[model samples]
Target chain A: MMKIFGKVAAIVAGSALVATAAFAEDRKSYPAPKDHPLSEIISGYEFRTPETRALQDDDFENPAYILLDLGAELWSTADGAAGKSCASCHGDAAESMKGIGASFPKWSKERNKAITVEQQINICREEQMQADTWKWTKDPNMLGMTIFVKNQSRGMPIVLDNSPEMETVRKLGEEVYYTRYGQLDMSCANCHEDYYGNYIRADMLSQGQINGFPTYRLKWNGVGSTHRRFKGCMKNIRANPFKPQGEEFTALEAYMMYRAVGLPIETPSVRN
Target chain B: MRFAALVLSGVFMASVASAEEIKKVEIVDGAVQASLTGKPGDAVAGAKVFKGRRAGNCLACHGNKDMSGEQFHGETGPIMDGVADRYSTEQLRAIVVNSKKVFGDHTLMPAFYEVDRLSRVAKKFEGKTVLSAQQVEDVVAYLLTLKE
Candidate 1:
C-alpha cells in the first residue's frame, strides 16, 4: 500500500511540473496585455507572400543584410569631433545591444518624453560622442546602423512603456490612430484594425504592426523606417505627411509599440 | 494685332470660367434634387470610372458581385451589389458628391466632389476633387443598375 501511494504521488508531482513549465513557456512566447482588443496578436510576418517570407528566413537571400553589414562597419569606425566610435563607449554590440531593440520607444527622463531607438542613437551621438545627428529617414548610413542595432534583438519579444509619464502620449497616439485625415477621409483603424485581412485593391492589409520595421520593402527596393512607411500611407490617402522625427510620429510609435507588445522583433525583415 | 490680343484674352478668360464652374449642389432631404452637369450621365463611362484606379477606384472599398472577374474587392464598406435597390438616384448623387453631408462624419466614404475644408491635402492634389461632377453622375448611374 505504501509503495502504491508513493508511485501515485510521484506521477502527480511530475504532471504539475510539466504544467508549470508549459505556462511559463506560453507567457514568454506571448506576453500580451490582458485587455488588448485582439484575441490573437499576429505578427506582420504571417501576412507576407511565401517568397518574401522565404527571403527573411535565409540570411544570405535577405537583401537587408547588405545594409546590416554596413551598420556593423559603422559600429567600430570612429567619427565626429570626439574621435570616438560607438565601440569606444559600448564594446562589442553583440553583447551590449542584445535585446536592446525589443525594448524601445521608452520614456526619457532627460528629454521629458518618450524616445525611439533612432532618436536615442542621435542623442548618443550628440551628447556622448559629440557627433552630428543623422537624417531621420532614408539616409543609408542611418538605415544601416539602425537595422544593425535592431537586428541584435531579432526574435526577442517587444517591450513597451506603460509608465505614468507615457499615459498622455499614449492617449494622443491612440487618438491619432483613430482620427480621420486627408481627402480620402480615412483613419489608421479603418484599414489596419477593421479590415486587416481584406484587400485594398491587390494589396492585402496587415494589422500595421511595427515589430518588423526598418523593413526591407520590395517596392522601395531597400530597407526603410516605420516613419517612411507612415509617410507613404499618408500620401496614399492624399494627405501631407508629418516629418519622421516629429512629435506626432513619436507618439504614434509609442502607441504602436504598446499595441505590438510581446511580438518578436524582425528588423530588416523582407516585405512586399 | 489688337483684335487678336483681345480674342486671346477672351478665350483665356472663358477657359478659366469653365474650369471654375464645378457646379453648385444643394442637399435637400438627404439627396441632391438636380443633376450636377444638367445632362444625362453615360453608364458605360461611369463603369470605366468605377474600375479605373485613377478615377473612382470604388472597388478599393466596396465589393461588387458583378465585378467578380476583377480581383481584390475590399470589405471596408458594404458590398455594392443591389445598392440601387436601397437608394434613389438623387440620394446616390448626394452620397457620391459629398457623403459626409448625407451620412454624417462617421462614414468612411470620401466626398467625391468636395474639395474645400479638407486637412493636409497633398500639394499636388489641393483644390482637386477625387471625381468630377460628371464622373460622380456617371458613377451614380452605374450604381443605379445594381438591382437585386
Candidate 2:
C-alpha cells in the first residue's frame, strides 16, 4: 500500500543523493610527507586512462555500487547467534563509522598484531555478534561490508600509527618489499619503486599504493581486497604468495599504509 | 676393463641428458669465455624471441631505439640501443646468462638462466629457467646486432 510505496521512494531518493554526492566530489591530489622515499607519491588513478577514472567519479556509473548497496542492506539485517545487526549497535553508519577507513591496519592490543579493516570486521562478527566469520577474500559479503565501511571515510586523509611498535612492523614490511622472490627474482621495489612511471609491455606501472584498495578493477570485472592484489602480484612473479590476513601481509599493509600517509581514502575506486 | 666401459657409457649418457639441461657456464671477471650450446645462434630467430611475450619479453623492460616498429617499449631498465658498443661478445654472454653475477644482486635485470638461488618459485616453473641455453645464445646474438 501507500506505506510500502513510500519506503521504496525513500530508498530510490537516498541512492540518488549518494550518486549525486559522488559526482560533485572533486578528485584531490596530496603530496607525500617530506621524508618519504619517493619525492612525490602518485595515486594509481593518475596512471589509469581517463575513461577508467571517469567510472570512479560517478557513483551511479560505478559498478561497485551494486555491492555497496547490498552492504547497506546487510547492515540492518540481523543474522547472528545474538541476533544483533551492525545497525543495532552502530546505529546510522554515517555517524558511527565515519573516518574509520583511513585509520586501519591498526595495532590490536588483544590480538597482539596489526589488523586490517577486513580483519576488524571479522573480529566484530565473531566476538560481538557470535557470527561465523566470512572467508577473507572470496566472500562477497566481506567485500561489500568492507567497501561500505571504507566509503564512509572517503576524502579523509590516512592517519598512521608512528609508534615504536609500528616501526618494527614497518621495518619488516620494508624488508619484504626489498627482498627478491621467485624464479623471476623480482622485488616489489623492482617494478613499483624503480619503474613507477614506465611501461611493462602495454601496462603502465604505478607506485603500488593501497589507498584506493578494495578497488573496482575492470580487468577483474569486480572489487578485490589489497591482500588479494598482493597475492596476485606474488603469483605473477612466480612466488608462493603468503596467505591473506597472515602476519606478513598485515605487516606489509601497515608499511604500505604508512607509505600512503596523507592520501585520501578512495575505497571502491575504479582501476584497470 | 668392464668397469671402465661402464664408466664411459655413464659419461656418454650424462652428456646426452645435459643437452636438455641448463648449460653450465663459468663467470670469469664478468665474461663467459665459452659458448653455451657449442654452436652459433641465428640472429633472425633471436629477434622474434626478444619480441615474443612468451619468450625473452625483453621489450617489456629495455627500450631499444633501433626497434621503432615494436609498440610500447619499456624504460624500466637501461635502453638496449647501441648495446654492442658498450660490451664485448663474452661479456654479453655472461650478462645474458646471469646479470646478477656481473652487476651484483641489486641489478633489476633477472638472471635469465640461473635458478639455484631463486626462492618460492611457482610449482610449474620450479627447476625451470626463463630461457634455454640456445635461447640465451640467440638473445646474446640479437643484442650484438644493436650497434651504435
Candidate 3:
C-alpha cells in the first residue's frame, strides 16, 4: 500500500513539473543537436533561398477582402432592433481590439469552461450589439469580420494569461501533442518535436510553428487557415481530427500561440 | 552490375523508343523493379523542388543542397546521390510510386505516385499520384543526370 502511494506521489510530482513547464513561456530553445533526433533533420533540408525568402515576404491581398469590406459596411449599418452597429459598440478593430486574438481560448471560471475566439465574437454581436447571431462557417459576413478584425493586431505578441483556470487546457494541448494516435501509433511530438526535420517519405518536416498561419498551400491549391492545416496534420497521423472550429482546436491554437511567442507572424506563406 | 545495367537500359530503350516496351519489360508486382530509364532527367527543375518550397520538399528531410552543413541531412533514405546507378528508371519509378512495395511492406517513403496521383502511373494510380506525366518524366530526366 505504501509503494502504491509512493507511485501516485511520483506521478503527481511529474505532472507538476510538466505544468510548471507549460507556464514557463519559452521552452529550451529548439532542441540542441545530439540531444534530439530532429537536430539532424534540419541539416538535411535545403535551406530557403532569396527567391523563397521573397515568397515568404510577398504581399497577399486577402481574396476575401471584398467580403471584409461588406462586413465593415454591415458593421456600420444597423440590422437589429437595438439599432446599434458593431462599430458602435467595439469602435475601431485596430484601436479597440488590441491583444484580443492572443488572449483567446481562455477559460471562464464564472461560466465554468473555456471559450473560443469564434464564440466570443458572436457573444458580442448577440448580447452587446443586439444583432442576430451570425451563422457559423458559410457566413461570409462573419468570416470577413473576424479576419479583418484579427489582422488589426497582426504583429501583437500572443499573451495568454497563465492563470490557474488555464492549467487544464494547457495540459490537454500538451497531451494531444505527445500522444501518438492512428494505425501508425505516431504522435505529434514524434513527427514535429521528435522527428522534426526528418523525412517520413520524401517531404521535409517543418518546424510546425503556427506563426505562418493562414498560409497558402500549393498542395491544397489555395490559402487555408491554421486550424485547417492543423487538422490536416492530425489526419496525416491517421487520427480522427477534431473540427477546425471546435473547442479542442481553440485550445490547441492557444497553446501554439503560447509556444511561438517570439516568432514573427508569417501570414499567407506559400507552402508545399 | 553491367548485366543489370544492360537489362535496365535495354528495358528503358524499348520503353522510350517504342511504346510497346511494356511487353519487353517484365511487370512483376510484389517485387520492386529498379529499371533505369537511360534518358537523362532535368536537374534544373529537380533542383528547384529539391531546394525550393514548392514541392519534393527533399530539403525538409535529407541534406542535399551544397554549401551548408546546417545539419538537416535526413538519414531516412540513403543519401539520394547516384540513385540512377543503383536502380533503373522503372525501378526508381516503383520506389517513387510506392517504396514499401520493395523496401518492405512497412516503409517510410511517401508514395509520391500513389498519394499525390502522379500522372502516367500504373493501373493502381488510376486516381492518385503527385507528379504530372511530364513532371515524372522530368524527375526521371533529372535522375539520369546524377552521375559521379
Candidate 4:
C-alpha cells in the first residue's frame, strides 16, 4: 500500500533538507515538499462548513459503520482463556469505563514506562482479555474494538494522573518530544513548536491538539482513530513505523496527550 | 378499542425509553462541560481555544495570522459556521484523531493515535506514540460546542 510517489518524494525531500541544512543556515530556507505532501496542518482539524467539511457519513449503510458495530460487539464479548469479556472485568463498560478514554498514555510503575490507552487495552487483552495481540493495521476486530472503546469517553475532559511514581515516564515523554528524529531531522517542536505558525506548503501551522480525532474524512472515506494519525506522522517523518503495541509509542502517547493538557476532546470529527 | 389502547401505550413507552438514553450523556461538570449553554457550542471558548497558541490553536493555519475580530477566520479550511448541525460530536472526534483512516490520499491530515508510530530514534521510539485517546475526546467535546 506504499505509494511509489510517496517513497520517491520522501527520498527527494529527505536528502534535500540535509543538503540545504548543511549549506543554507545563513540563508534561512523553507524545507521542500520532499515527502508525502509536506503539510503544516493535518486537514482533519481544520474548521470547515457542514457541506465543505465533507464526509462519507451520509451513507448510514456505509461499510465504515460496521467497524463501530464490531467494536460494540467486542466490547462485551469474553476473550480470555478464563472466558472473560472486557465487560466481565470492567463491569459494564458504560458505567465503569465512563471517561476512561480521556485519561491515557499513563505512566506505569510496574512496567517502568509510559503506556498508551491502546497498549493498556492490548495488555488487558493478552493478560486479562486472553485474546492474541492484534496484528499491526490488519485486524479489523481489534482496530474496530479499540476505536469503539475510545469513542465511549468522547466528551470527557482529559484527566491523566501525574503521581511522583510516574516521574520517569513523564521525563521520557518529554525527551522524545524534544529529541530530533526522522530523516527530516525535525522534532515535534520543530513544526508544532518553534515554527508553529509558519507554512509548510499551502497549509498553515497549528499547535496540534489531540482533542478532535478518530475524525471522519472524505479522503479516507470514514472515521479513523488517533493511532492511525500517529502512523501518518511517522511516515511523514520518514521513520520506520513501529508495531501497534510497541513500548516507545506508549511513552510518546503520554507526552503528546499530557502536553495537550486542558484541551477538550474531539472523538469523531469530520474533516475535508 | 384494543388497537387504540396498544398504540397509546407504544407511544408512551417509546418516549420514556428515549428520555433515559439522553441521561447517559454527561453535561453537568459545571459551565466547563459546554453541553448546556448558549448556542450549540460556546463560541467564546471555540474562539479562545481555536485562537490560543497552546489550546486548540486553530488560528495557526486557516485564518490570517492576526487573532483579532470574529472575521479573522481560517482560510486554508472553510470558515467555521454551524458545526453542530454538520456532524455530531462523535463524528468529529474520529477525524481529529486520524483523518487518513477516512480521507485517502489527503495531503493535509495525519494519524494522531499511534502517538509515536514512527521510530524517531533507532530503537528508542520503537514503541512510541503521538497522542493519547483522551486528548482526542476532549477536543471533540470542545468542537461540538462550535454551533451557532
Q: Considering every candidate listed, which one attains the maximal lDDT?
A: 2
Interface RMSD of candidate number 2: 15.3
Which digits, one per residue and each the tens of the lDDT, describe model 3 over residues B1-148? Answer: 9999977875564344323221122325533344334444566765644544334545554444341544455534445565566566666665554555555443344554433322222342234333433444556556656554
Largest DockQ belongs to which candidate? 2
After superposing candidate 1 on the true structure, give the runs of residues whose Cα lies further than 4 Å from its correct spot.
A1-32, B1-24, B101-104
Candidate 1 per-residue lDDT, tens place, A1-272, comes to 23532453465446545643443343323446898755456677777788989999999999999999999999999988999999999899989999888977778998898888899889989988899999989888889999999999998988766688787788888887888778887888877875665567878777788888898999998889999999999989989888896888888888888788889998889989
TM-score of 1: 0.84
**lDDT, each prediction:** 0.81, 0.81, 0.53, 0.52
CA-based DockQ, model 3: 0.07
* Span of 10 residues, lowest total lDDT, candidate 3 chain A: A39-48
User: Which scores higher on TM-score, 3 or 4?
Assistant: 3
TM-score of each: 0.84, 0.86, 0.52, 0.50
TM-score of candidate 4 on Cα atoms, chains taken together: 0.50
lDDT ranking, high to low: 2, 1, 3, 4
Candidate 3, superposed: residue stretches over 4 Å from native: A1-56, A60-81, A129-139, A198-202, A266-272, B1-148
Model 1 lDDT tens row, B1-148: 9999977885564345335556668888668988898888888988877887767899987779988998888655667888888788988898899877876676677888887768888876677677777778889989999999
Model 4 chain A: ten consecutive residues of lowest lDDT: A28-37
lDDT of 2 by residue, B104-138 (tens): 67678888788798888888667778777887888
Q: Is candidate 3 or candidate 4 better by lDDT?
A: 3
